[model samples]
Target: MPVKVRGGLYNPYDGHIDPYSVTQALAAGARHYGAVLRPHTEVTGLRLREDGRWTVTLGHGAQLTARRLVNAAGGN
Candidate 1:
């Protein structure tokens, strides 16, 4: 047996992926784990209460309390 080629590259960890689909799947998984998804909502401010909880202020002066917060602010 003989092989002939000008140039080539092989990698076992190389592949193509659709970013939008991946993002959607991740969001779905988060939702399954009881994650609230609020799109187009802007976080105005954050305050720590005396009880060690976080008071997150959103746009239009709306506020919500949470034990933990995740800032996944994507690019513009």
Candidate 2:
């Protein structure tokens, strides 16, 4: 058997950065923008408020309010 391809291999720019460094930088930037990062918190429910904001219900009956929510769950 034989395999055929129209285009050959294309290698883009190669780079590497420490994962911890990236995470730290993102945390710092978020803090600079007045964003709060809550680790170890589990989201139990989510609902839209009357003012179009989001009411996030966390574990232990804790709640959070945000005008916008970003679900960065999966990798790019």
Candidate 3:
């Protein structure tokens, strides 16, 4: 069988990222701003409150509210 090609795209500014290093730097920056890093915490649910705050439900039935949320769930 034969195929026909239409067009292609290219960019000279393309780059790759080291996710681990980037995450470490970001975590350090966030910690400098009083952000608490909880390791091994499982989030069960999340909801947006009427006051524009986020409600995060944990696996242990504990709920936390914050104005901003960052989902940095990594892969295995």
Off by over 4 Å in 3: 1-19
lDDT of 1 by residue, 3-69 (tens): 5554334557867667688789989998998889888899999999999899999988999998778
For candidate 1, give the lDDT of residue 6: 40
1-76, model 2: which lDDT tens digit per residue?
Answer: 2355433334366456567787799889988998887776788899999999999998899899998876644343
In model 2, which residue pairs have backbone atoms overlapping below 3 Å? none
Candidate with top TM-score is 1
| Ranking of all candidate structures by their lDDT, best first | 3, 1, 2
Per-model TM against the reference: 0.71, 0.69, 0.66
Clashing pairs in 3: none
TM-score for model 3? 0.66
Model 1, CA-based lDDT: 0.82
lDDT of 3 by residue, 15-59 (tens): 666667877998999999988788789999999999999999999
